[model samples]
Structures are given as C-alpha cells and as structure tokens.
Target: MTSTARAAHPFITSHGLKAALADGEEIAVLDVRETGVYTHRHILFAASAPLWRLELLIDRLVPRRGTRIVLVDADETLAHQAAAKLVRLGWNQVSVLAGGTDAWAAEGFEIFSGTNVPSKAFGEIIEHRKHTPWIDADELQERVARGDKLVVVDSRTPEEFAQFSLPFAHSLPGAELVYRIQEIAPDPETLVVVNCAGRTRSIVGAQTLIDAGIPNRVVSLKDGTMAWLLAGRALAHGRHAALPEPGPATLATARDRAEVVARRAGVRLIDADELARFEAEAGERSLYRFDVRTEQEYVAGHLEGWRWVPGGQLVQATDEYVATRRSRIVLADWDGVRALTTAAWLAQLGGHEVFVHAPPALAPRVTGAEPVRVLPSRAAAPLVSPLQADALLNAGQAVAFDVDRRAAYERHHVAGARFAVPDRLQSFTAELPPTQTVLLVSPDGVLARIVAAELAARTHRDVRAIAGGTGAWAAAGLPTASGAEGVLTGDDDHWYSPYAHADHAARDAGFRAYLAWELGLVAQLEREGEVGIRLIPAA
Candidate 1:
C-alpha cells in the first residue's frame, strides 16, 4: 500500500467529523471499511468506496485534481493506504483523518448508517444534471411491449445482459458506455435505460450517458430486474452477442480480441462418444474446463468444467494459464454461441480436436434459442490433426506449447512447457524447437485447433489437442496437483508423461515473475483501447 504525499490532518474526534460535515465543504467522506462492515453502517454523507479500487475511482471517475479528497475507514491502516494511492496520482489536496471513523464515533459524533445507497445517490446526482429520470418495471415493460422506440440500454455489463435482460435492451456496461456507445447504441433518438443486479451501474451508466450530451433520453431501470421480478413484470433474458475470437494480430501484440475469442469459444468440441467415455472414466492428463465469460458472471453460475477466463484476457495471456497450457480443452458459457466464435478463432491457430459445450438451457441466454445453422467445426474446417504429437514434443523437434491464458498457464501446467497462445503462436518462432512436432494444449480446443490451422496455413503441418482437458485427466484418476495459494510457482507439481516444466524460474525468472505479478487479484476485464506492457509468457 502506498502513502498519501500531502499534509495529513491530525486525528479528529467525532466532533471534528460532524463539524466538517456541517461546514458545507465539498469534503468527500470516504468509508475505508471492509465491504461487509461498511455496508452495515458508516458516517453520514460518507461514500463507501472500497480501497481495492480507490485508485480506480479517483483516477478514472473523479476528474478534478484539487477535489478535497478525505479518507475515512473503520481502520486507520486502510485510510492511510488509500491516502497514499490518491497522493501518488498527484492529487495535492488529499488528506486522511487520524483515528478514522471509529475514532469519530468514539468521540460521540453521529455516524451514517445504511446500505451502500450514498454511491447510488452520487450517481443520481450526476444523472439529474442531464434531466435523467427513473423508470419502474411496469413502465419499462409497457414501453418495451408497445415498441416505445426506446433503446433499452442495459447498463449492466455485457454478461449481465446475457444472463438476464429486458426487452429491446443492449448491454452497455457503465465503464464502456462512453467508449462503446457508438458501437452498441448510436442513434441519439433512441431512449436508453441502465440496470444492474441493483442500482450501481444502472445509476452510473444512465448519468454518464446523459452527462455526455447524448440527445437520447436516458434513465435507470429503477430497482433493476430484481424490481421487475418483484413487480410481476416479465423479464426477457435474451441471447448474448457472439464475441469473436482474437485475430492473429490481436492474439500476440494485442491479446484483447484473442482472449475474448478463446473464452467465448466455449469447450473444445468433443465427439459425443468421447465426451461420454471421458465422463465414465477418469485419469490424469491435466484437464481444465474454462467457461469463457466475465469473471463476475462466472461467479454467479456456470457449468462444472469452466474456469472463468474472459475471452479478451485469454487472447492476451493464455500462455500463463497453467491449466489450459497442459490440459485438454472444454469451453462453455450460458450457451454455445460465444464458444463457437472462440472455437473458430482457436481452430485458425492450429489446436485441433475442439468441442463446443452445449448448454441444456432452452433459452440459454437470449431466447434459449438453438442455432439454426450448424457449420462444420474448425477440426473439419481447412485443417487436419496430426496422428500423434510426440514428434513435436521431442527435444529440438517442434515447439511444445501451452496455449491458454497466461494466468491459467502459470497456475499449473505440463512438467516442461513453453508459453504461447494461439494468436501469438508465431511470436516465438525463433525460440521454438524447429518443425519437430508442435504440441499444443488448451482448455478450449478451439484455440489449439486455431493455432494448428494457422501453423498449417503457413506449413501445412499437423498438430494435436489434449483429448480431454487436464481436469478430465484428473477426474479419470490420473495424477493432479494441489497446494496452498501463496507463492504458487514455488508449489509442488504432479508430473505428466507427455509434457515437461520449462526452466522458468531458473532461466526466465524475471520474465515469468513480471507476467505472474498483477496490481490486483480478481482483475477487471480489459476494456478496449487499453495499451500497456505485461510480463505474460510468449504470445
């Protein structure tokens, strides 16, 4: 945790806090308490902004540098830490009151108590400036049914829309609204409404759109879908957009599109018999099931095999995802639509034996509609699999690649592995063990297949996908890995026959450590236009 560079005020009792509140000053009363504790009670007028994203809120949303930023926390440690983060961002006028809110309450000052409504009020304040209003479930339902020509802007993130939506709604997350607005809802005449599990994104998104001077009418679907369900209004959880796979360019230099493609590609398309047999049997070949969706959505619900990897990030860091690197792939989501798109992209990259998971839900995400046209998969598309991958795995033959997200690769992988995602399959061409057999692995067969196809496109060579994901191997009673979470790379490994561990720490410690490190855990999905350097493995 960093320190606030500005002059910090001495600890003030509750009296001072109350005095400050009554001063009519534009002091931001911040709640630095844990999320659970803060939600139960906080000082009146104080905002409950978690420290994990103090920088996220200050740097991105709160624009004015001189805005008097105050840090308040149930604990002093958090407030001080937050203060430093703000100061580092060059906010000169920042300060944290010593003793924090607990000290204030101890001094007999009034503390605000309630759920996280202040932030909502804050969003409302921003929206009200643009004359934005709130719409109840009935009104929304009526309007949508009447074809009110309103643009139902589901301000909840895309997965939220995919999970559940109102009529005529297009998902535009709060953060992406300003940037993705043109792509999702361009017509100014169309009305837009924001929503979320509750009020946060809805309120924020609606306000943001209005503040941008959008000629369209913008409002929050007040109370969101929860309110809709309670109000007896119909809910329309519809089909989500088919996020495409990352292209060759995107997979390597910009893993953005590539990750999305891999995540959304769903499971490696397996033969029905093979899938059934694998379920009936268990062995360890390092298998993993990745449900390619936003992490938040994955937390809500998902298939058993899926490890959450947002497609965009997968394209960027597949090589680090240890599970995908060594395991056979099975990709899934609310339905197969996204998985198919991801699969296609992976096929181009050359990992064959791809399979798309078929969600049993009738209206998977949007309409639970079944696809009308079933195209032959990439396995059958313009490429063929190698009879065996041993030739590539042999030393000095071909590149032995772990083709998945870098994060997944780093956690657990083949004993001796080389990092490379499908799109960046060629980024390490010079480093590869020349035309030996190029053995590829991924939880999503599509990416592996895509890499193989791309390699073949250049050399007409064959490649192999792990028959079952690494997870499947373990389920089949094969060897598996286990360890405590801290210092993961230092943990023990259960060996696999076909693959080997790379001399990462010994030879490439700096590079591996660089990619393995992150500013935060539970990372947010990378929005478009994010440019920066990273330490993830090859491609």
Candidate 2:
C-alpha cells in the first residue's frame, strides 16, 4: 500500500488490535510517547518510540519497513504525527490505535506500566515454571563473611557493574555466564551466584548455567542488588572487576555444553545458505541479524550488515531489540557458546523462530560501530557553529534549548540552554521574546536539526540548530552547565529507575513498588492466558 492510502485509513480499533495480537501475526505495537508518559500506562507489548526520535530509532527497532506497525499515544494525536513520519521513512503498513491507549482501557484490555514489560514478565514466568534456585542477599552476605568458597558473578553490563556492585562480585554479563563459568568457577564443589540490578538478568543468568549442566551449584541472588541495598549493605562503587576471557580449554568445554543446551531447547543451527534465504524473505517477514558478542569484539570486526547486542543483554531485553513478535532471529558469534546459549533462551522464550549461525570460521569483514540509518530532515534549518552559538547566547541574541534525553541534559549541557522536550518545543518557545532567534541542541545534533526544522515551520520564527550540539560545544572549550536548572518540562521525558532517585525515601519506595510489580507478573500472565511463552526442559 502507498503512504497516502495508509494515511486515509490509518486507524485500527482497540478490539481489532487485540484480536490481531492474539492471532499470532507479525506485528509491532509502538507507544509513540516520551518515556515518562509511556511508563504511566501503555499496552502490554508496545515498544516505546517517542515521536521526536521516531526516525532515529525506527530502523533499529523495526528493521523491516513492511512489517505491520500499530502506534499508540494518549489520544492518537502523537500517533498520527508518528505515523506520517514513518510513512515518509518507507514504512507502508503503519496504523494508529483508533482512540489510543485510552480506547484500549475503555475496552477492558490490559494496560501495562514500566519499560520492557514483556521481557520482565517473561523472566518472572521463567522463574515460576523452571523453579530457578535463588539465595537472598542476607544469606549471601553471611556466606561471604564466613569465607564460603563461592564466586559472585554480576550479569549486568560492565558499565553497570562498575557503577556499584556487591562485595566480591565479578562482572560476567548474562549471555557470558554459560560461556565463561568454567573459568570463573573452576572447582566443581564451589558455589556460583549471579546477580543484576533487579531480577530478570539474575534469574535468566543463573538458569542458563544450570541448563548448561555446569558442575558448580548455581543460584540467582534473589531480588539482586536491590535486595542487598535494602538489607542495609553498601555496594562497592567504581569497581572494574570484569572477568578475563576464558582460556582455549575452557572455551572448548563451554562450547560443547552450550551445543547440548541449544539442541535440547530446539534452537536451529543455520548456515550461510539458510541465512541468505532468510535475508531474501526480509520484505515479507521481519528478520533480525545480531552479532551476539561483546561491544569491543563487535567493534573490532563483524558481518557487514549485522548489528551488535551483547548476548546476555539480548536475552534479558528481547523486546527492546526485536520489536516485531513472531519474527525470525539469527544470532552470530565465533565462539559457539555465546550464540548457542543466547539462542537457547530465545527459543524457550517462544514467539520468535531462533537460529544460530554456525560459521565455518569466525572471520568478519567489517570493522567499527554499526552504521545508523536516520531519515533526512524534512527541511534544513539554518545552522550555527558552537563558537557562534556561544557568542550569540552570551550576547543575548539567541535563546538556546537542549533537546537531548533528560539524563544527558542533567549531566552537562551547553551553558544557559534550557531543557525542552521535542514534542513540547513549540509551546515552550512561545514564551520567549519574539525577536530572539531560537537555538536547539542535541547529543549529536541529528535530533536537534530535525526538531529545528519542524519548529521553524510551525513557529515561523528564526530557529537554528547547534552544528554539532553540546558535544561540539564542549570540544571547543566552551563553558557548560550541569544539574536540572531551567528545565521547562521537568522529568517528564524519561522514566526514572529507582536507583536514579536521589531521595532515600523515594528510592526505597520505588524499589519496593518495582519488585512487587515484577513478582505479580506471573499471576497476571496466568489471568491473561495469552503471553505466548513456552518453557522447554533442559537436556
């Protein structure tokens, strides 16, 4: 269908969408609102794609332009806007929820709060079905104090582990648990504990080891680091204790174990010819090609068109990467362990057809980061260099606004620039003096440019974008400001994790609410009866 044709009949009723979801068709339901607004209430399976960043993230979130996409917003206004943008970006099968999420609620459908709902709920379901073993923070602390011969492995990304982690915890992100356990805990009699910030990764990580038939006794740290902090334990900050790569002997053993697990889980092993066939069917079906390796390894070399997402993170947050339900996924890695182990969990997660690329050799032709495909700005706005923007701001000739994520804005932005949510930019700028030229800034300037062009057309005022955004300003030795000064929208752009809260009371309350939400997911799934997860027994 053409873009214009889609625009004419671009709405699906809530009832129709619910039927479609249950019918097992390949579809991606996106909630086109900022993170904060999305976290308040959204459809159970919808991915978050704020209107402002639609073009920037559409390719990564939904690779196949022809995949059926249904967008939701508070009342369909923003969904309409996002739909128009997606059509321009070559997506044909796009529609908005007729009355938005409100309409869904009116129809007595389930509405979920929080990000990565599907993945977190799946984690809870896994623990319930598999009966994954776990140890609480208090008991683990006592064991540590008593000098128990056990190893603690953190299943979060290295960056998260470095921020704060439990005592004696070594970083071995989720996907790596099965592949590196032989080296991390060499003794068969030793105990192994896995943890993450919250529950999902920890449970998934521990289970991966058990399913692989590792010799050591493996258990997830119940409630993870959140429970530790709640139990009045201090996390070690700025720790860089990531484990070393497994030796060749260990890697071979891990590969053999992972192969058995993958076979038992029914994860398909594909070759070059099969992958080519999958690529050819991309127009008709959604296909995701992921190099399931560490970021450093991916940057060093990878398949030309494949994207990099660490194996552990991929299993923990599948919805974030694969937006289309029932799509085909291909995981690639040189070592058999990472790709095979990741595919094992994904296969058990159900919905999608999971496969591992069993390449003859690990050689890759491409180098550096995956290239990002961003839609061209609708119109080019006048641009000013960082130095020019600095002078203009200092001389009161132009008023500046930062359009980056709230967390990035709070970290450090161009001095004197007020933070503005892109969707609310026009209203925020209306309060400014008519004669002052508006300057917009973003992390990399792509979003700033896009917003500038739209704002210029709407407001008909002199609007311009900082050429390279705040990063450029800092690079030029210009002054910058930090903290939440001059924030117009105020914490309404992104959802804050409990750890993000500064107030001790609020943080504790947030954690309690979050844990309760996770714990209640299995019950919710039982009531709903359409989550589509299938638990496969380990061999």
Candidate 3:
C-alpha cells in the first residue's frame, strides 16, 4: 500500500454524482480498475485509470488541480488508494464514488461496457448525422479488377498499416490525408477510397475530405478491411505503400482548403506570443501542447516540449490524450492544413478550447526527444549484464522474469525464462521457481528496474535487472524462444481491438459488438449529459 495518508476527501453517493451531472458541473469520474475490468462495466463518462498505472497516468488524466475528480472502483480499496495518490500529487477537489460502481448501478444510472467507447460512439454519431458515403468490398474489388483510376488511402497508424490492409491501400494515416491527398490524387475526377482496419477511421477520414471540399469523389471502404476479410477477401500484410511529400502547389492548395474547413468549424488560431502566454499559465490551467503530425515528420523535427499525436488518432482517441475534462489544447504543425483541420474537428467533437499554433518557421527543426526510461532517481537494484544472466541461468542459480507485454514475451524471450506482469507480480511470484535471485528483464532496461525494485520489496530476495534488457541480450547473439511458455497474468491492460484480432470469428464478433455499442452511445450521451459534442453538418 502507498504510505500516503488518506486525506479528508468526501465520498459522493451515486445519487449525488447524478445530481452533479444534471447540475452541469465540470467533473471527471475515473474508474481505477484494469482496462479489462473497466471495459466489462464502468460508469458512463468514467475514464479508466487502472490502479497499477495510476501514478504514471494521473498527471495526464487530471492535469488541473481544481477539476472535480471522482474515483470509482468495484470496491472502495482501489478508489481510496487512487484518491490518496492523487491528493499526494497535489490534486484538489478529489473525491471517491461511494459504494463504487455497484452504487451507481443500484441508483438506476447507466454503466457502459466497452473500450474506446467515446471515440467509437463519436464516429457513429458523425455517420448518423452526416451519412458518410461508402463503397462495399465487392464493389471496390470489382473496380480495381477493371483497372479503374482510383486510390485507396489507409487511415491507421503506420505500424497498424504495416500489419495488414487492402492491397492497393496507401499508408495515408488519418490527418495526413488532409495534406497529402492532393499529392496522391491530383486528378479531381479520380475516385478516392479511405479505409482503416475497421469502420471508425474510414468513416471519419472520408467525411473529413468531403467536408474539406476535396474535388475527388471520396468514399469510405464500408466496414474497412474487417469487412473485406468477412467477404472472403485476403488483406496484404507487411505492405509499405505510403504517400509522397506534397509539392509546392499541392501544399498551397491543402493549406487553403484546410483553412476554410477550420474557419467553418470555428477553430481558434493562436500566435506564438499568445501561445507563450498561455503556456506560461500552465500551472493554473491544464494545457496540452501537441504536434499534430506524422511520427516520421515529428521525429525528423518539431518544436520543443511538444508531443506528437497524429491528428486523426488524437481526435479519435481524445480521452487517451486529454483526460482532464474541459482542458485547453494547442495543436501545432509545419503546414497549417493538418493542425487546423484537426483543431476544427476537435473543437466541435471534444468541446475543448482548441487552437492551431503555426510556428513562424517550423520552430527550428531539432531532433525529437528520446523516449524516457522511467526509473527512480535512486534505484538500488543491481544491474546484471546479458552475459552474467546467461551464466546464472546456466548455473541454475537465478530465474529470469520478463516484465513485458505477453505478446512481446511470446514473440521472442530469453530461453527458459518466465513472463511476469509487473503490476500483479505479488500475486504471481508464488508461481515462479524457487530461486533466491530473480532476474527482471523488459524490452528496455528502464522498466526492468522499476519492476526489479518492486520485486525486491516484496520477495526480500536478490532482484537484479538485465542490463539494457532484451535488446542487449538479442544484440549479443543470445538465443531466444518463441511462444508463451510461462505467463503469470493474462494480457488485460489493453482491450483487444477488433481490427487487429487474428481469428476471423473473434474479429467478426468484435466488429458486431463494437457497432452495437457505438449505436447506443447517442442516447447515452443525451442522458448522461457530458459528451458536449455538436455534430456540424457538412456544407
């Protein structure tokens, strides 16, 4: 348990919470449970903040100290623990939901069950209001077979696009399509098809192009690649077709068109000086500065202190980005198109004060920040080299515990090693072999140390991290084994995405369930009264 004292925080009953919602107060109700548990059932508008990750995520979730926060759990333990942590982190107006989610259910209030519910619901809402046009897989396949002049744009992350997509689909992920479409499809008469692994991105991407008044006849690939697979079509895997850089003429046109759409959506523009002033006051208000650009572009160069969130995914998963309800957001991009277009949609869709920040000259190109290896300032666990670990394993003196995702561990892990989910290690340690020395390994050394520290505290055994983690081990020509040999806990922190499921039956079921959940959100939003989304009709 955290050593922080439980502060004098009020516990609001479900009835009181309902009243607060009805009264239009600025509040964020968070369910402090694992993603799997939260996805099964959680209060509507309650974002997931799993207890294990509460500390790492709380800053992003409740950035504002004064925002009214209500923590909910199946039991009061997680809620109380989370509240104590939040209070220790200097969050004010923190409270716990009395009697937890059960109390909310007992009060006859809604309890939604699903992952990415807000984004999925919003996509459905957009489709219902705008009636986004789409083409079925058979029609698209026939058109392609006939040598039709068209382009298929895949609106998923680069990694996801690489996994699987339509054969002809170019990796023009989400917001990038706004700026890159002109270069990819210069001919207005050409048919442009947008697709994702599933429906949401395709629907939103196609509609965005239409709304921006792109001359092409843009349409969504109905039900996306999942539908294609269901229709007995095979998707291409490991594809790398991507859009080229926009020329001067194409870039100019994109900026012009995007500005018009931004104006229509009432996206606010902030100059550098104004943004500086706004950022200076971050202590008093929650302000998220994001570079709404592709990861490659962001990696090549971006302004300081700005994180990259591809515009489309940011809007699609706003809750994942901004957890503090009603926080201000400032979006930046090299060209005005992507950021402005994203800001416009986010303004209406997120109900947040959104702004577009156009740097004078791309904010002076600099290498992006390195990925942080989260570790305590002072870590006591000794770091062991891969060679040392190998000798220890050969001698049967130490057991290696891989603290990584189950999928990663199954892909390639140290031979004869066991998998351990760091959060549940205490409950899982008993399953490990009887060894005094425990070797903790992660994809990188940073996470291994944290888990190593935790294991050290719990077992009172010699806990050491594999120096440089699996990467170093692999780099040293160490042999690895594939498949889940010894998994301590099920991979439940992330809800399974329908588009990525390998099993056809499971994928189909996920799609059906996702669509059903989405269809119900409009009524829920109306009753729950806090989504704050206003559907702007396409002109």
Candidate 4:
C-alpha cells in the first residue's frame, strides 16, 4: 500500500536549496544521483535512491500513509517529475532539489562517492533532449490553425491520445502508421503534419513520413502537444480514444501503396554498401536518419548515431533533420514499411537524394556495409506475453498497456498503463524512462515482438515485453472501460478526421480537439494508476 500523495512545490535553484536547508525543516531529501556520487559524499541525511528503483519500488518505498518527500535528480525535469510521482504515491508534501548535487555543493554541502557507481542512463535521457529541437505550444497551435493545408497527426500512444492531444490532430502513434497509412491517411495531395509528446517522436515521426513516399507534403510538429499547451493555444476537448495499429488487410494495402508511392515519388533503393558509399561521397551535406520504433527499444541497442526517431513525428521535424531539402536519409524498422513511407515524405518535401528501404538489423554501421538480409519484408507477427493473463495485470509492479489500432487505444485501456507502441520505438535516445523495466502491452504479443526488438536494438535500458498484449490484460482480469476509439475498420470510416468524411457527414472532426482530449486522458491515467483494481471477465 503506497502512502497518500502530497502536493509538491516547484523546485528551488541551487541557491534556493541552501535556504531550505538553513531553515532546517524535517524534510526527507532524496538524491537521484549515481550511487557513486552518493557514496562519496552527500547532503547530511539524504537518502540514496536511483530513479529505476523509484519506478519499481514506489509501492513499498511509498506506503499508503502520509509523508513529506523531496526528490533530487541531476536533470531538472527528473527531479520535478519525481516530486510529482511522490505526490501521487500519497506523500504529504514533496519538493525537488532544484540544483540537484551541483547546487548542493555550491552551498558547501558535503557529497560522497561510491565504489559501485549508479547507472547514468537516467541522466542520459535529458542530455539527449538537448540535441533535440523543441517548439512551444503557441507556435505549434498557430501552425495547426494556420490552415496551411498541413495535416497534424498525433504520434503518441493511443492511451496518451485518450488523455489529450493538440487541437485538430489525429492519433496516428508511431509503430502502426506504416501498416495503416492507406486507410487512415489515403489522401496523397494534402500537406502532412506529425507530432508527439516531445522532441523524439515528433522529429522521428516527421522523418518517417518524409522517408516514405507520398504525393502530398509532410512536416513535424515541433515540441509536440506539451509545447502546444505551453504556448497557450486552446486544445480541442473530447473524451475519445483508439488503437494505433492496423488489421492484416489494411497493412497489406498500405505496404502495396507505399511501394507504388515511392516509385511515383522517385524513392530509390540502396543496400548497406551503397548507403556507406553515398554517405562517404556526400561530404558536408546534412542528413537525418531515424528509427521508427519505441524509445525503450532504441535504448537497449541500436546503430551508432542512428537517432531513435519515431515515425509519427516525421511530419513535424523535417526541418530539423534535413536542411535545404538536399540532404540524404536512411531508415528501417522491423521492416522497411516506415522507412519507405518516410522516404516518400522527404521527396514530397522536395528532397532529391531519397532512398526508401533499410538494410537488415545486423547490417554494419557503415552505409555501404554487407547486407544482412533482403528488405521490403512481409508483415511481421504481433507479440504475446508468457505468464497467466490475469497475473500480468494484477501482479506487483504490473502495468497494462494498449497495443492495437489507434482507435482501440483511444477507446479504452487497462488502467495505469504506459504506451510504447512499435512505430516510435526508435527514438530511445530522446524518449523512454530510465527507471523501471518495460512491459509492452498490445492486443497480442504478436505486434509486441516487433516493437520489443526495436527497443533492444537502440538503448541499454533493461527491457521486457508482455505477450498476449491487451488480450493478456483482458485475460488477466484487469479492469477495462469501453467507448474508446479504434482505427477506421473499412473504407467508409473516418480515419483522417477533418480531412476525409465518408458518406453523410457534418463538419469533419478536426485533429486539434482529438489531441487535446487525449493528452488530458494521459495525465489523468497517470493519477488514476495508483489504486489497485481487479476485473471479473464478463462470463
């Protein structure tokens, strides 16, 4: 039983921390530093806990009682986030160490070093974002409402969409876009827009669409939904949700269309060897490379310098990746579906040096390395979990997630689940929580396996994927609510809201309202996840 959560105050700067200490309040200061730093020296009476442990041990470390907690992490966001989580876990009061250790030392605070150093993976996630470009809410909303004929696609997890999203955006997510573009976004003439929670997926999503060939234009929404909110733009409000994947038939059609689109858009093919030669020859040229998998996958392992980019953001971040529309690009996932789609988008953006397929996973880092396997792979199998279904949902440290069509995700999901679908798995460098092992939830582990491999390929984050996906959640007897959204099942469904309305429709459902509602849901779910709930399957 976790402790009752308390409200947290915005962190004080390094100087601010000294003032707090001088006040001598009976506060529990948490140091989220590498165990090494803690061991060498630390603020008097500061507890040493890593972020990873917090995500996993919150239930035990935070009892269902009352306590005041303070979090201190190197990155500014991490400490603030930790303080927020503490509040959720029933703390009476929570504060973040503003300057973390650096500030403490500046105030003549003592610190310690440990023989066994704490892992710096959590610290790394922050540094990675520095290299990323961000757009605020006002700027992004202006673009969305600019009526520039740009399409804004929400590349977040379906659950995230259910929480809230940008005004007039669609929940496309990252993993499944490659499989469902034709049904969700069949129009090839409109400018394409993409976004995610932050920089990683948005940049990666835009890049994905650019790489894949399409007749229309494509761009990424800088800084994603959060930026939009910060910019003070109004978000469309609604309580709708959906899955971000596609059915078999829809996937096939999208794949077929991708091949044709690439051909029409002039997407070229290159093996590892050719890619290497091209990179060598294209000196002084700026090129953007991305992986359209989940962040966790990229953290586990990935090609060096291959940015862990999600496919959904490809439409928004095209500007950041390629400069002046003359750069080279390469991409791949479990298959080349996302790569081709992104390639096409690049061409639509007026890029000439576009190559739409990716070499095998084991292909050498060099552009012109030996071929590991042929590409343009057949549809991959979805993933599944191994344990008893109900156990997966009810077990300690368990989290239920959605891994199907975008509509299914927006429609409903087991409570307290985090989404890391396949399409955006490649941006691990910029995404992914450094703490806690990952358990991927999907309809079945079928799609989960494809996403899992992508995470393993990108980062060293400890990773594990649940099979049986959301099916396992249902099987595990977890609570579920209905009315969530699913993808457009047929040609008649409105996959791209506000753009394509089928027979008998009013004003097209804009993407802005859809995204805002979804982002709200994600925030809500984070709060609701603290309580334990068990579901009885409908007999």
Question: For model 1, how does the per-residue alpha-carbon lDDT over 466-492 read when each residue is reduced to its tens digit?
Answer: 444444333445433422222222211
TM-score of 1: 0.35
RMSD of each: 24.0, 2.1, 3.3, 20.1
Quote the positional error of residue 85 for candidate 3 in Å. Answer: 3.6
Q: lDDT by residue for model 3 over 197-274, one digit each (tens)?
A: 777899889988998889999999888887788888898889876568898888898888889888878888889899
RMSD of 3: 3.3
Candidates 2 and 4: which is better by TM-score?
A: 2
Best-fitting candidate, scored by lDDT = 2
* Pairs that collide, model 3: none
Model 3 gets an lDDT of 0.79
TM-scores of the models, in the order given: 0.35, 0.96, 0.90, 0.30
Candidate 4 off by > 4 Å: 1-163, 166-170, 174-178, 181-244, 282-287, 296-301, 323-325, 361-539
| Superior by lDDT: candidate 1 or candidate 2 | 2
| Every candidate's lDDT | 0.47, 0.87, 0.79, 0.49
Model 3 reaches what TM-score against the true structure?
A: 0.90
Model 1's lDDT to the true fold? Answer: 0.47
